[model samples]
Target: MNIAFQDSKDIDKEQVMKLYNDVGWYAYTKDASTLNNALRASLDVISAWDGEELVGLIRVVGDGLTILYIQDILVLNAYQNQGVATQLMEQVMQKYEHVRQKVLLTEEASDVRHFYEKNGFASCDKGSLVAFAKLEG
Candidate 1:
C-alpha cells in the first residue's frame, strides 16, 4: 500500500480521531481537542500515511535525554499484520537509540508482548526495573 511515515505532529484532527477509533482506542478518541493538544505536546509523534490516508500512529512523551516513553502506537485493523507497525517502531527506535531508557505498556496478550520484544524491549519482569501506573477509565 506504499505506507509513508511522517515524523511530525502535523496531522489533521479528524484523521487522528478516526485512526484512534479504527483501532478501538475509545479513551483517546473521547475528546478530539484534548487529544490534539496531547499530540502537540508529545516529545515526538510519528504517523503512517497511505496516499493521504492515515493508517497508523505512534506517540511518545519524555525528557529527550533520560527516559522516552511510547505513550501510544496503533495501526488500523485493516492494516494490521503488515510491516507498517514494524517500520513505525524501527524509526522510533532509531531516532531514540541514544536515549537512556525507552518504555511502552501494552495489553497482556502474547502477540503484543512479542511485538515489543521483537522491537528490542524487555519486559519489566525480565529486568531489574518495575513499572507502575494508576489510571481512571
Candidate 2:
C-alpha cells in the first residue's frame, strides 16, 4: 500500500466526516460544521492518504510549546493495523519533539493502552501524574 502523509488542516469536510463515521465516531460526525471548525482551529493536523483516499488522521490542540494535547486520531476500518496510525503519530512526535508534555485521553481498553505504550506513552496512573476531564452533555 502506498501511503502519503500531509501536515495540514485543509482536508475536505466530507472526507473528514466519512473517515470519522467509518470508525464509529458518530459524536464527531453529528455536526459537520462544528467538526470542520474544530479541525480548522487545531494547532496541528497530520493525515494519511492512500492516493486520494483519506485513510487516517491525527490532530492536536495546544500551545505547541509547553504542552500538546492529542485531540483525535483515527484510521479507517480497512486501514487499521497497517501502520497508518503509527505513521501519523510518528509525524506528530517529530513535530513536537521539543515539547515538554505530550498527552492524550482515550477509552480505557487493553489494546488502546498497549498501542500508546508501544509508541512511548506511559500511563499517568502508573506514575505520580493525574489526569482529569469534563464532558458536556
Candidate 3:
C-alpha cells in the first residue's frame, strides 16, 4: 500500500468528522463547526491516504513547540495492521521528536500499551490518569 503522510490542510472537515463518528471513535451527529475548531487547534496532523481515500489520521494538539499532546490516532478497520498505523505514528513522532515532552492517552489495553511503549511512551504507575468531557450543548 502507498503509505504517505500529508498535512490535513486539504482534508474535508465534514468528511473526517463523519468518518470518526462512523468508526465509533466519536459520537454520531457531529457538526462541522466543532471539527473546524479542532483542526484549527491542532498543532500538527498526519494523514494516510490511499489514492484519494483517507485511510488513517492522527493529530498533535499542543503549544506547537514545547509540549505536544498526541490525539486522535485512528485507522480504518479494513486497513488495520499492515503498518498503516505505524507509518502514521512514525510521521507524527518525527514531527514532534524535538519537543521536550510528548504525551498521549489510550485505553488500558495490553496491545495499546505495547504500541505506545514501542513508540517510547511510558505510563505513570504512582499517579492515576483521569479524563472528563462535556459535550456541546
Task: Assess every candidate by TM-score.
Answer: 0.96, 0.98, 0.82
Better of 2 and 3 by lDDT: 2
User: Of the pair 2 and 3, which is ahead by TM-score?
Assistant: 2
Order the candidates by lDDT, highest first.
2, 1, 3
lDDT of 3 by residue, 19-68 (tens): 58656765423566767677667887788888877788888888867888
For candidate 3, give the lDDT. Answer: 0.75
Q: What lDDT does the true structure give each of the candidates?
A: 0.91, 0.94, 0.75
- Which segments of model 3 are wrong by more than 4 Å? 126-137
lDDT of 2 by residue, 49-110 (tens): 99999999999999999999999999999999999999899899998999999999999999
lDDT of each residue in 26-104, candidate 1, tens digit only: 9889988899999999999999999989999899999978899999999999999898889999998889889989988
lDDT accuracy of residue 11 in candidate 2 = 99
**lDDT winner among the candidates?**
2
C-alpha lDDT (0 to 100) for residue 123 of candidate 1: 93
Candidate 2 whole-model C-alpha lDDT, 0 to 1: 0.94
